[model samples]
Target chain A: MNDALPPSNQTQHSSDQDKPNTPITPNTRRILLVCRTAPYGNALARESLETALAAGAIGAKVAMLFLDEGVWQLAQHQKPQGIGRKNHSAMLGALPLYDIDTVLVDRDSLSKRCIDLAELGDFTQLIDSLQVKEVIADHDVILSF
Target chain B: MTLHTVNKSPYLSQCLADCLDRVSAGDSIVLIEDGVYGINCATSETLSALNKAIAQLMTLGVQFCALRPDIEARGLQTTSANCPFNLLSDGDFVDLVCEADKVLSWY
Candidate 1:
């Protein structure tokens, strides 16, 4: 954790400090949520999705990039119930409802894993390694999960 | 038999080689997560030596398997006639863990 940045909750209310009585202003910063972990085996994947949803709810301009094992979260036909966990892919389908429309998937990560677009559905913008650098450069704030 | 699991990419970490050094002829090795990238064309001498070590271990009766999901996620083809290791499904991975006397993870 970097000491320079405030915690998530603090960042959420940072805009309201000057006008305590007023409602929090809609966030204007462009946030890129970078997810790079596999789902089910750990909590990072779920935590990253929750963070994205939270930021989106605050009216922040949010986009998501699924890289490395993070692409596994987008895989279809996931039946996590046997493992006593909710279906992560189903949760991802809710991103658009939260106004997180700019979901990106690393093309190299998917191809390296043998996953085709059909397996991941049609919700994301596929980006190559170079485009990944461009997308990062385009964002104002990057939150890795 | 021991089951040694490697989950870090050999290109970026020392986990695979360290695991290789510790594995015996009868121990089993299962590549998972980024470790599955080991099957890709070697990009360094260390990786080539690791591959050679894996092959030599196989000749000495060491069983090697890579997780099917991780392998497929990385788009690696283990079904080819010349593929070096076997692919294990999640259930099979569970079985491999149960069959081994001990399990060591290098991640």
Candidate 2:
């Protein structure tokens, strides 16, 4: 069985020192959080939101852009209240308060889903697919969720 | 003139191997999504196999890249934890695009 290997042994990730602290200090470092899914679906989706919120709270200049299927996350008039949830809709509203104001929604995705901005609240911004690559160009860090 | 993107996971094998198999040796592979999970695994034979394939590709001049955020999101910020791969940001991703003749998504 010497040739046999374990299941956990995978590829190599980055070093620990590269990880930032809980309160990421805003330096000249620019970050982009790519939100490609709706909220409350999986851990990654929530984690991406948390990272954006945390980064923004710490005065980090961050942008939250949604593309592909992610456009559904910012839909207007969410009523998860019936599930006895925290009204994620409200929590979503807090993004701007936390300085996570730069929200980008793909225009093509909107047309694909037939989503209307009038339904999504005034906080959301619609962008085209071409602009996304350009936007990613300006950031120092890109976090795709 | 070539971009290095890594598809280190078999899950994306179709996304990459399907469309990317036709790509010449100069193309790159950037591991994102479940791709970054390869960091510091539990000594699984699968990890070893993936690493071997990656090594072969590297020898052939295929670039392998692991997105920074994907690694961090998995709480792999421990650096010395498990998997060791290159890091790239959105700006880096953009620079790659600018460097490459064209960019294709595996998944």
lDDT of 2 by residue, A24-108 (tens): 4455467877665566666656677789888877777888877766677777677776765555556667787887778877787
**lDDT tens digits, residue span A60-94, model 1:** 88899887778999999999889999999999999
Residue-level error in angstroms, candidate 1, position A107: 0.8
Which one wins on lDDT? 1
- Residue-level lDDT tens digits of model 2 in B8-67: 455434333322332345556666767666544223465454545555555667666667
The runs of at least 3 residues in candidate 2 whose Cα sits more than 4 Å from the true structure, single-residue gaps closed, are: A1-26, B1-28, B31-107
For model 2, state the Cα shift of residue B51 in Å. 27
Model 1 chain A: weakest 10-residue lDDT segment is A17-26
Q: TM-score for chain A of every candidate model?
A: 0.81, 0.74
Model 1 residue pairs with clashes: A112-B74, A112-B75, A113-B72, A113-B73, A113-B74, A113-B75, A114-B75
The CAPRI classification for model 1 reads as incorrect
Per-candidate interface C-alpha RMSD?
17.0, 8.5
